[model samples]
Target: MSLRSYLVNLKQALSSRTFKTPYRIVTGNQSADMDSVVSAITFAYLTYSLKTPNEYIIPLIDIPREDFALRRDINKLLSYHNITEDLLYFVEDFDKFLDKSTSIDLSLVDHNGLQGVEINKGFDGGQVNVEAIIDHHADEGHFENANPRIIRTCGSNSTLVFHYFHDLAAGQEEFWESNKDVIELSLGPLLIDTSNMTQKVEDPDIKAFEFYKKVLASDTVNFTAQSNYNDFYKTLKTAKKDISGFSFADILRKDYKQFKFLHDDRVGFSSISKPLSWIANKFSIQDIKDDLSRTLKANQIELLVITASFTQKDTGIYTREFCYYYEGQNEKYAELYQLVWQQLELSTDLYRSEAISSLTNGVNDSGSHLKIYNQKKVTATRKQVVPIVKEVLEK
Candidate 1:
C-alpha cells in the first residue's frame, strides 16, 4: 500500500462517528523531532500495509497542532515530500476520544517510556494497552510489560523500524519494489539523527542504510544515496536551527519534555537550539523568567531546567548554557539546584570560569531562580544531563 492510500483510509476512519475496536495509535516523543516524527509515520504505514492484527492503525504526531509549526525543519521536509497536515493527526485530536471507553493500543517510537501519554489527563496505564516500543534512548522501565520492546543504542529509531519492515517483507520482491517512496521518507530521519552516518552510527544503522540502498537500486526510480544524504542532512539541520520569529514561550516548548520524579516532584526540561545570550537579546531576563514561571505553574512542575546551545555564525564555535528556576522559598528546588550545579561544575568536559561566581547574583537573590552558567566547553547534551539530574533527585 502506498502512503496516499493509507492516508485516505485513515481519514475515512477518523471521519466516521464510531471507531472500530482494537484501535492502535503509533506515536513518538513529545518533542516530535525529525527522528520521532518519521519513525512513527513510517512504522505506522508499514504496519498498516502489512495488514497487522489491528482494526485501525493511526499515526499520531504526539504534539498539539500549534506546536507543529515550531518544528520548522520537519515542516519543510513534510512539505517537500507532499505530506499534508490533513493526513496527520495531533495530540489535541486524540484527546477528544480519550473519554470514550475504547480499547486503544499504543506503539511508542523514538521513546520507550510512557512519558508521551502518561501526562495526559485521565490516563490509566492499565486501561490502554502498550503494544510495542522501538527506541534508542535510556529506558526508564515504564513499559516493562509491553511486548516486542525493541530498545538499543542505535543512531535513530527509524533504523530499527526500517529493518523490521525489511524482515517482514523478506522473500517478497514485489513488496520491496512498490515501497520506494516509503524507503525514501524513512531515510530522512536516519540521516538526520546519525548526522549523515557520521555521528552515533552503529551496525544496525549501517545495515539499514545498506538495505535501503539495495532496495532503491532494484526499484525503477533513480535515487542517489550520497546526494540524497547531503541534501537532506543540510536542509534538515538548517530547519532545526531556524527559530527566527518564534516567541519566547514557543521557543521553550519547542523541544520540551516533562518528567515526574521522587514522590510528587515534577520536573521539566526545555532544549533550545539558540544560546542564552541570543534569547536575552531578544527578550528581557524578566520576560524569560516569567515565561519559565508560567510553564511551571501550568504544568504543576516543581522545577524547570532550560539548556541552550549556540554556534557562532562566523567562527563556528559552540557554547552552552544551563538555567534552573522554581518558586520563591522552595527548599527542594534550592537543594536540587545546588546538586545539579555542583555535578556540572565538576565535569571535566565543561569549563567554568573562576572569575565568575558559581551562582548568578540577581536571579539567585531574587529567591525564585538559582543560577545560569556559560558552560564554556559545551560538551554535555540533554541525553547526559537528564541522568545526572535523575541521580541527584533519586538520592
Candidate 2:
C-alpha cells in the first residue's frame, strides 16, 4: 500500500477513541536536515488534523553551533507563512532544558516523553529525543521504548517523512493536492543531503526523479526546488578533486622518493593544510564515514586521517576539514595528509571514530570497497599554472 494509506490506518488505530489534552509533539534538533523536518511536520499535521484544534504542540529542538545557512532557509520559509519562533523551541542544551521541566511525573507527560523520561536523564547528545527518535541510521537506538517506530536507512530521512505526509494528505480528498507542497519542501534538503547524486543510496536516481516531478508541481514559491541552489553549486565546485589535468601516480612516484610510511595501525590519523576543498563541497562527511563503515566491516580502519586545512577566502582565511580512512597497511595516508596540513599551517578540524562496521565490509560490484577515497593530486603543472594565472589575471 502507499505510505499515505498506512498513516491513515495507523492514526485510525491509535485514536479510534479518545478525549484528551493536545499532543505535544517534539522533534529533535534544528540542525536536522530536511528529512527530519519533514518527518516532524508530517506528524504534526496528522495528529492535529485527526484530532481537535488543540491536539498538538510541535516543538523543534535547536542545536548549537548551528548551520547559519540552513537556519536562514528555515526562518525564511517560516516567515513566509507568518509562523513565529514561539512555535519553535530553541533548546541549545537539551539536558538543561529537560531538567528545567517542572513536571517530573512520567504518568503526567504524554506518551512520547515517557520513554523520554529515562532517556533524558542519561542522554548524551548525538541525535536528540532518545524518547522520540525517528532516524534510520544503522544501530540507532532511538525510540526503543516507543511503539510503531519508523526508522529506515533510506537515502534521506526527509524522504520517509515525505511519504508519511503524502499518505496522510491523500486520505483527505481536499488535502491530496496540497500534499505535493510537503514533498517539495522536502526535496531541497534531500538534494543537499545526496549532493546531487554524487553520494547515492538505494534507488536514489529513481527517488530524485519522482520528487522532481512533484516539486515542479508545487506552486508554492518558497517551497520551490531551487531553495538551496547556490549552496549546491558551491558544494559541487568544491567537491571536485581537480585530478583531471594531472597524473597523481606519476607525481607521487617522483615526489615520494624520499617519503616514508610512519605508523601502520589498522588506522592512522592526520590533518592537511588547505583542507581537501572538494571533500566538504559535494559530500557530507557522514557519507564518507558511512561508506568507510561498510568497507572496513570492523568500522575501525587500519588507517584514518581527520585532516584540517586553511583556505584563503574573502574572510581573510578559514579552516576546511574532513576525515580520510583506509584499510590494509597504508600508514602514509596519515603522514602525508598531516604533512600537507602542517605545511600550510592553517587551522584544522579534527575527526575521530572507532566503528568496526566500516573496516571489514566487502567490496562492491566494482571490485572496490563500497566506498573509495580518491586522493590523487591535480597535475603538478597546475601549481606552475597558478603563478601564470595570477600574473595574467592580476596584470
Candidate 3:
C-alpha cells in the first residue's frame, strides 16, 4: 500500500478503534516541533520490517488534535503533501486510550525518553514494551534493552529518519521515485531545523543532505540548492511565526512544556515566534498577567518562562527575548527568581519599562512576578535553557 493511503487508513482505524493490539506506536517529543512530527511520520512509515503480524506500526503526533492547528508550519508542510489532519492520530488519542492498553510497544523518536507520558500496564497480564529508539538528542540513557537503539547528535532527527529510509532502500533502485512525497516530507524538517543548512549540520553529503538538496533542486533550476532550501525553510518559518490569528493561550500551548525541578518546583515554559514588544502592544499588562495567572493555575505551575524570537525587520538580525514570571508566590518564589538571575547566561540586559519594572521589583502586584531580558544569545534553545534552569532550581 502507498504510504499516503496507509496514513488515511491508519487515522480511520484509530478513530474507530478497529486495529488489533500489540501496537508499536512511534512518538516524537512532547514539544511537537517540526523535527519531532516529521521524524515520527517518516520513521514509522519506513520501519514496516519491524512490525510483526497483527502489530500496528503507528506514527503519533505528540500534540492534541485541537492544538494541531496552532502548529502552522507543520500544517503547511503536511498540507503540501495532501496529508490532512484527519489522516493522522494525535498524542491525545494515545494518552486517553492506547496508553493503558494491554498489548503495546513504543519507539522513541526525536527525544529519547517519555517526558509527559505515563505508560499504564493494562491488566496484570498485559504486555507493554519500549521496543526501539532512533533519536538525535543527548541520551537520557533509557530503554537499555530496546534493540537498534541508535542515538547520535545531528541538526535534526528527521535527518536521522532519512538515514533510516536510505539504509532500508539501499538496494532498491526505484525506491526514491516511488516514495517521492514521503521523501520530500522528511526533508522539510531537516531544512528548517538546520536553518536551510546554515547552522548546526556537517558533512552534508554523508548526511544525505547533499542528495536531498539535489532532489529539491530538481524541482526547479531557477535557484541554487541553498537558495531553494532557504526559500522552503523560510516558508515554514513564516507560517509558524504568523500568530495573528491565535489567542494568547493558544500561542503558549503551541510550543509549551512543563518542567519539574528537585525542589518540587513546577515551572511552565513557552517559546513563541513573535517579538515580545509586539505582544506587549497587542495586549494590556493586566490581560497578560491574567492569562499567565490562569495558565499557572490550570497547570499547577510555580512560574512561567515566556520567550519570544523573531527577525529584526529593518536590521535583518535574529532576535530573542526571555522573560521570567510567576503568579502569587512572592516569599518562597523569590529564591527561585534569584537563582535563575544568577545562573542565567543569556547575556541580556533587562528591557526596562515602568510596567515591566513593577513586576520585576514586586512593586505593583503581589499576584505576579516578571523580568524581561533582551537575550543576546540568539540560538540558546529550550534544550540548552532547560538544563541550566534545572540545575540551579535543584540547588
lDDT of each: 0.74, 0.38, 0.70
TM-score of candidate 1 to 2 decimals:
0.88
Question: How close is every model to the real structure, measured as TM-score?
Answer: 0.88, 0.44, 0.86
| Model 3: lDDT of residue 343 | 45
Give the candidate number with the greatest lDDT.
1
Across residues 122-184, which tens digit of lDDT does each residue of candidate 1 receive?
246455677789889988777777766888889888998887777777877677678777777
What does candidate 3's lDDT look like per residue over 43-143, in tens digits?
A: 77777632342235788876678888888899998887778887777856664555545567888888876655333323223455778888887787778
Candidates 1 and 2 compared: the better one by lDDT is: 1
Candidate 2 ranges beyond 4 A from true positions: 1-23, 29-38, 50-54, 64-86, 92-119, 122-132, 168-170, 179-181, 204-212, 215-218, 221-395
Clashing pairs in 1: none
Q: What are the runs in model 1 whose C-alpha is more than 4 Å off?
A: 51-54, 116-122, 217-226, 313-315, 341-367, 376-379
Candidate 3: regions farther than 4 A off: 12-18, 49-55, 117-128, 204-206, 215-228, 314-317, 330-332, 346-348, 351-355, 358-364
